[model samples]
Target: FLPLRGILPDMICDSKSYIDLLTIYQEKARKDCELVGNYLYDLLQKYCSKNVSSKAQLDDLVSIYCKNSSFLNVVRTSELKQEYRHENNESLKQYVEQLPAAQQAPSDGDQSESMMTPQPIFAQDCPELCWYIGLRLCDLFHEKYGRYPGEQLKDIQNGSEDDNSREEMDTDQRQIETDLHDLKLIGKQFLTDHELAKHQGGIRDTVLEELCRYGSCEIHSIAAFVGGCCAQEIIKLITHQYIPIDNTFIYNGIKQSTALFKF
Candidate 1:
């Protein structure tokens, strides 16, 4: 889902000066984001002193950093009390004009191919555990199969299929579309595989057809549900009121099932 793994370094390399600033705050918070942010603000102070002359420009710089920084996803919502206005929680996209102009992505080709600024991981970095593994697999598929999940579905489903299709999509919708496209294709591959016979209930054609029906779906019900749940947990931790769940929540709307497990 995140292009961070295996490709993030190249993205961040688009901003080596800012990337070097990260070295000043690595592994420095319990969440490990606070220290990095402090370091970022310090470097920002120096940069702003020399280059940024206006609050608007400074906001733009900070906003772009918020959108690209690895720590951004961890901090923006939970730490910022965003209350789910956006998922991917890009509370900062409004501020980013482009990846900090301190360094720009190498302009070797068209903007489409150069959209991503890949930042590589470091030795001390903690591994990220995302639930959307299928999406990650699709990224891998792009390397071997020579197509992104979105491109795969694009072959079959016209993205602008709906009347509102021409509508502008925000960053979060774009992110979700990319992931959903991957999920649909990966699910299709899994369904066709004879080895994965244990799982059932997916009528392959019907499932894929349904997915295509909403080819450009940007549904956010799940975002609100998940966001509210997370906000509740954060409040509990801050107010020291009701106890939070121990861990793991498994929700399956299609099966109408829910399970909670604590290890």
Candidate 2:
């Protein structure tokens, strides 16, 4: 069973509902099989940070996630199944540009950053690529493992509560507790090894080839590739602008490549 720490951060990092957000994202992704992208990692890092407040609203959390360039690229690339093109495409861009500036009121003559301040890219076109890839990953997990990652968490929580309630714990609770004991086991076993390996087998080399061919390997390399190829379809719906078809153009090209890999 995966622990809350294992997956909660990723779900909360997106602008999804915090209560059961992980389950929701997993379910949504499972149903759509798209919407998977780097936004999950971005959200995990932002919400899981030591200093960040845990009580952020969904929009605030989305704003925070959108602020980061990596996350924005993910969003731009991720795909969505639903078709929702705006009638006034130019108006959408203007509205995005005119989004209220982040409130910067001072507190006690010390300029304390407003918690709800929107990032420059928050109102920009949603990160369709990240969302699509993330969902696809979740769907892959369910198909392979025959269970959602969060189900293990629910089992752990239920087992722990049952253990706590019993005057003398039973074998079932003991077994459940033992099963849920090592949270990282799933990350090491499923996410890193199995899921990531499958993902790599399918697209990792293609992504690498594209990056190398373009002579740029910045974070945006993956973001833009994922965005243009995966997110362009979705953006067509949201913006209703006839985006010119891209012909294998790399957004952030770099010659050097990193050997270290982590999910």
Candidate 3:
């Protein structure tokens, strides 16, 4: 489960291994759900991201390859949304006193120059939030329609012999595209809709592009690495000892390389 994924991110972010993180993580995870504690062992093994009405039953599902476990055992969070906002906001506040003058915004109330802060509501570019949004879109589309975007994509490219099937596929393609368009509006609207993130915006288009590229594959090593990177940035923020990431970070596991971008 989803609940285990929530807790695992914290553990991964801390740079603790699966077995090593068991002690503290077990407690934190259990605190989230008693079923999580009961199923902690299996959850630590191979787990599925299936629908679970209850933690106990959710843990019971042995189907679906828990592919992420290796990365989890090696990789691997909550309402991903809530955890992300809280972590970013709390960490940024702690970093204010530590940042250099150039990094910090002027207190003179000048709106001419934009400001970037850890505050989720005030963040200029939060790839992490956008990342979650992309994943959410993937899940939403799949659940609403029985097929994935990728699958439909394949069907379209391959072409269907049956006119009815082909037409249906075209309809699916249009619907998915509409969903993507809605995602853009959702990102911008979310800021205005929720007074909390007012003007914050919904999500990023680049994030959406990435989700389309990757489709349903949930890469654990990548996720865990990102978690670690976030942890490091937050540490730098709290200690004010080092420069926190002023730009978004990108890692290419295929090439085993990393790059930073300022947007």
> Which parts of model 3 are misplaced by more than 4 Å?
1-133, 136-165, 193-202, 209-263
lDDT of 1: 0.40
lDDT by residue for model 1 (98-201), tens: 12222222444554421122222121211111112233344554665575433423222235465444343333246435555656666555434423323322
lDDT of 2 at 37: 29
After aligning candidate 3 to the native by TM-score, how far in Å is the CA of 34 from where it should be?
46
Best by lDDT: 3
Between prediction 2 and prediction 3, the one with superior lDDT is 3
TM-score of 1: 0.26
> Can you list the residue pairs that collide in candidate 3?
5-77, 6-77, 6-78, 71-75, 72-75, 187-202, 187-203
Whole-model lDDT per candidate:
0.40, 0.34, 0.46
The 10 consecutive residues of candidate 1 with the worst lDDT sum are 123-132
TM-scores, all candidates, are 0.26, 0.18, 0.30
Q: What's the distance in Å from true for residue 236, model 1? A: 2.4
What would the per-residue lDDT of candidate 3 be over residues 1-27, giving only the tens digit for each residue?
444322344334443566566667666
